[model samples]
Target: MEENQLNPDVDYTDMLSICSQALDFYQQHGITELIHAFNIANILGTNQFYAEAAFFYKVAFNMHSKSAGQFPLAHFLLMARLVALLKGNFPIKEDEMNQLKGLCIPLYNFVEGWKRYKENGDALSAIRLMGNCFEEFHTGEEADTIYLTIMMDLFNPNPEICIKDRTFGAADFNVIPNNLFMYWDQNPPAEILQNFEYHKGLTHFNLKIFDKAEAIEWLYQNYGVEARQIFLSARHPAEAADFLRVHVINYYGGWWLDADIKIQSIDKFCSIIPSSYEHVFLLTHNNVVHNDFFGSVPNSPILNDCMLSLYRNSYLHTGLFIAYKTGPGIFGRALNRTFYRSLRGETKKPSVVLLNDRKFWSVIADFETPYKDSTPHWQAS
Candidate 1:
């Protein structure tokens, strides 16, 4: 009969017969039956056919194991073993454990080789293989242990890795002090911090502004008086201001800039210009369109509330401000306490003195704008 003559409403038995014939024809054509069998096993497993699915999955896994190395086949075999164990058909054995351990040795070796190649800048092939490795073997505590071991080995180099390019190093990049102050609570990855510090640039650590009193003390003790000058901020306003005071008292006096404001370049603008107001800079609302960025200061009753109101009216950003040590005083402490209280929802109103009248904070810019090269800067509202 012509193929087009076949009825759409064919009976189940007729469909089964046709499918069986087609499968047999494919098998006779030397097509690998393993893939079909593996697919069938998955379908069966999905349909709760545990015993049948385990048998087919094992068949597929063994076929692959013989052709591919054990590492490449581990995922399929592991799944097969899991399914068998779930069905009570397979049990953990000494021989099976040995096989798994053997597989792991090569996987670790592979990862180490990749890491070495990556360090030497000859990692094209190794980098390509990393994805496969992660996908296949990211399982259980054994994998975790292997990863940790590899990382430890890589990082424990005697000479340590160095960047060949100096421009990307801390020296070339202009590190803003403001950025450092803002990220006071940001703890970057250890590797990142190490790289930055190796270049003698700004590095960061995250601390619970309220709870890290001991850590703060420890840092001071280890790094000495110079380390006390490193800028930091708290997640909450109250905590940040309090932390600032604590450091101020210890360091004698240092500047504290809110994180939200971004400076174009403090080194070029402030460092080069030597004036009596060198210690002080004019802060204006970011949205103020006046030719002078810093025109007038805002005097609001409730500082936080005024900040919120100014933010609402002139659309001025409230977070940008610089606080310098003008002889020891209670103003810093009071601001810190007020900020804390406002954050805790304790105060119905916020008391923010508008430093500038230009309507908005200057730091507001595109998300990807680079605030500083090597220096720490603020990223506030």
Candidate 2:
């Protein structure tokens, strides 16, 4: 709920006051700008005023859809409207619901498909409906994001579709390397170091910690200068970590744990992934795949997609939210693309396993990160 949202640079606290003033202006003089309407919706949405956000989002959508051709941003606003409606649990009018269902738009079709799934509890149908939307759109950015949002929403109602269990045998462990990696920018506090040592003691894997200098050098050596440059261009240390973790795991074929992450029971943790599994990661109760901790075999297609996402988003969206650019945004979209392709028999389904919250928390307890106050975390950044 504390997500940085579309643009964190906006001061929502000040915008909330401006939003009220604008509403008053609209009521009295009927003054409204298209950009203002969209900004109001974004502020309200980030503040969790979903019902009001939906109103402004609709206004923005209507304005853009009518004023011009089908620009992609207009569709994004439409998607936002549905998300606000869904998140707020606001009742849709019978006439509006009918209108949404009758529209030839792919987004509307997807929303109607979601409604059907809500009624019938058919997970595969909902997935296929989302897949159909993906097939229609060849572009990235907002289109891929719409797919990610829909996929996240679907996981909540049909939890069974998201969980993947991997029970590794003794022989299974031999194939996958026993390397565990974590990174810190520099000057790790004693508390963080203690946590690192504790995890190292618990697991048999060769735990490797990389400082900022070492991380940059490793990226340069393995991924070449372009990768190193991306790491340098990162606005924050954590963002740089996002770029590095995937590359390291993809090349080395092992586990990458965030510096803040602490494993509770090594026995339970080590038991999760089997040798045959190409990818292993944890999914939160909210259905986001955690980039903080994950494992993969060498040259995983999923991680390759993640690396590509980092480069593409860096070039295309210079200042996008880190989650969407280098974090779970790309992670979830890659999974959906892989899964959808698998459904069509276009490619082999990747051997991916997602540990649910129940399974994930059993071997790991959440700890207050030492740099919680000092570092600019994604939500605040």
Provide the overall lDDT of each model, using Cα atoms, as 2-decimal numbers: 0.34, 0.68
Per-model TM-score versus the true fold = 0.21, 0.77
- Clash count (model 2, backbone only): 0
Model 2 lDDT per residue over 1-381, tens place: 222223324333433454674455444533145666676677677777887788777767666644335553666666677768776877655665555545536766666666666667666777676556753443233445445445544433333333144454564322456788999888888778887888778758888898889988999998899889989899877888888888888888888888776777755665644345567767777567888877888888777877777788888876887887788777876777776676788987567666666766765667776667776677555
Give one digit per residue, the lDDT tens place, for model 1 in 1-381.
111222334322332233454335334532254565466555555555565556556555565645454433644453444434344434435454455446554444344444444446443444333322332332111222223223323322221222223232334212212222222335444543443343233222221221245435644774454333332333233334433433432232223333323334433334322222112222223211111121111222222222222223222222323221111112322233343344346774331222233212332222232324544432321
